[model samples]
Target: MPVRALGYKPVYDYRVDQLGDQGGAQGSILVAGTWYCPSMPEPLIEATSDLHAGRIDRETWVAHIAARKPYRLMPKESKDAEGHQRMMCPAEAGKVQCPLKPRSLGRGVHLPLVDPQPSPTRPLKVCRQRAITLAPEEGAEYWQALDYGDEQWQKIYFRPRNSVEGHANRRKITAWLDSLARGGQRPVRRTNRRRKTKPLGTWTPTGHLTPAT
Candidate 1:
């Protein structure tokens, strides 16, 4: 039977140690993390409701549900007014046809089959023109050499000869800006050595610090 995901749900409640033999430790279940559990049939309804309400994430919910044993609905022999047996599983009622074929075997049967021809394999061709190498801009090497102090600036400036280079460059620039915004460098402080002094009746300059009376 096909199981459709109606929504999210809580699938397990016990510690990892309870799972046993599989080698897991007991701990509180994280909503979005992976979990292992033994299969159960009833609590799945409440778990699914919790998941849809944002109380749990899909990972833990799925793990809890998967740990439970699968339920199989067998078709009943009783037929309705239309002479059709009602579907045992409501989810599959409208879509799937019930198994109605009788179990039997006849005396003689004839069978004929032919072998299929194998498909032809073709050799893969490589184009030298398509395999172009990437090179840095003329001034890029100079700027990288001065800024990074490395001759390997070619590796940093050059990129794969493809459409993704622009996107990659944007990502690199964004990362650099984020790092700068974090204030990773320390600020430099300036020190003063000047001193102030006072004369007999008025203020005066002793060394660098002098006041006019």
Candidate 2:
């Protein structure tokens, strides 16, 4: 967050170890600083949520992601050098369908239209709007260098991170093993315990020390 406030655009690597449910206006939910559609299913929203909380296993989380027909971001107003862009909602952009935007239906897109028509109880502005403008400040804290979960993200994040961590861990293991070979009492502290020593023999009456057999 501070990094963005400082006007530096830095891509992030996350552990996702903590629990968070930060959301934004228009019922959009924030994950890694990117906003997602409100109509996102409970399974999709809850995928990482349950896994991080230890309520679900990796396989189930993978299944949840696989089951998702996620909305895609389309550029409506192109981003300028200042890093601002306007995006169309899935309903209008034809990435996914919603009953609210009937024009998007049956456009040969593979996604399904919203089920169970909206009633007065469920009226939402997100349904009415076609596009949203995102400033660099809008999601600066969690803004991604590329769209989250896309092939670009996977390529940029995983391989380099894994390689660096792997090499670092390997070097640490080697150093600790070398310390133990030399009887280091605390390998991490880089301190060794000295071996006890004894005199070969006591001084004799003639001032000659005798060796112990």
Candidate 3:
């Protein structure tokens, strides 16, 4: 939380708890860390749960996620000096479609139009507004600068994590060698010694290996 106050948005994999089975906010559902329309297909809400429960196969769960698109961030003007920014629901942004948002039907030409079955008797705030303003203080606590678990998040999180760890590992190795040197011990360099396999052959009584004719 302190780091967030200093303007750092943490990127992390969704723990089992973060995947919501239902809408976490008045008119929005939380998936990974982002807010989505409450009408996000039920299977998607249940995808992570089903996967962990073994009720669905990895392939099926993967397909579910593969079909999922990322949320679109609104314009720069949506935010002031503060960290708060206006974000459009996935459906409204045209990443996906919902009958609730009539314009969405025309939008998301290449995206899936989900039938929001058993439509909410009373539409939530998000379905009606199409966009929501989130602040760093509260609702956006788990919020990701990049859509969580999407290709962008992977690109943003993985490359840096790997490269940073590589630097740390190298530093540790160097420090260890320095410690060894200070103690008058030579650091042993490791070498790869591959055992060469013999070609197809027969062992003769004279302890000779004869290759096949």
Candidate 4:
């Protein structure tokens, strides 16, 4: 009856059992006990459970089943006691096992310092102004200033054209100029005009220079 209903497929079979409500088909109608449909592939029940747990979506689950063929039927002997078959994926199963002590690509590569010998013929030149010469008091004061104001002394003595300290100062000045240009701060640009007192005239005996009359 199951075969007929399923279009007489060789994959499926049904068993009949005598139930109370049998609609007078001799004794009992053929009731399907455990419907075996070999053609209808088994779902990835584990993957489905994973999907339910929000680990994977339906599309990914379908793709995984298609790629892995987890639904493929196995022989009875191949199946476990619980009727579960072990799904072996070729991509995962056929992976080469790594050795305990694997060979390294940089096996022969070693760090070695190569120091070049100094030229004995050519001596390094020194500036006379930069030569070390100072009185005991001057040397003491220099050392004191150096130790006391390390950063300030460095700025004053040996300043760099481009440095963090100089860049910070430039940024502050630029910000002040930008604020002034935007008319945000108090200080504004001032305009000047000249007032003409009088035209050139001949000097008389009077204190003030006046036109001759």
Clash list (residue pairs), candidate 4:
none
lDDT score of model 3?
A: 0.65
TM-score of every candidate: 0.18, 0.65, 0.61, 0.17
> Which parts of model 3 are misplaced by more than 4 Å?
21-23, 57-59, 70-77, 106-109, 117-121, 159-213
lDDT of 2 by residue, 1-213 (tens): 566555655655556752234455454555544566666666666677777789899888766655443554456887776677777666676677776678877776568555534566755555667777766666565566564444566688788889999999998888777667355354445556575775435335555655556
RMSD of candidate 4 to the truth, in angstroms, is 43.2
Q: Across residues 125-185, which tens digit of lDDT does each residue of candidate 1 receive?
A: 1110111111222111111111111223223434343347788889877766654524556
lDDT of each: 0.29, 0.63, 0.65, 0.30
Which pairs of residues collide in model 2?
33-142
Error of 1 at 105 (Å): 33
Clashes found in each candidate (C-alpha, N, C closer than 3 A): 11, 1, 0, 0
Give residue 23's lDDT in candidate 4 (0 to 100).
Answer: 22
Model 1 misplaced stretches (Cα beyond 4 Å): 1-42, 64-69, 76-83, 86-213
Ranking by lDDT: 3, 2, 4, 1
Q: Which has the greatest lDDT?
A: 3
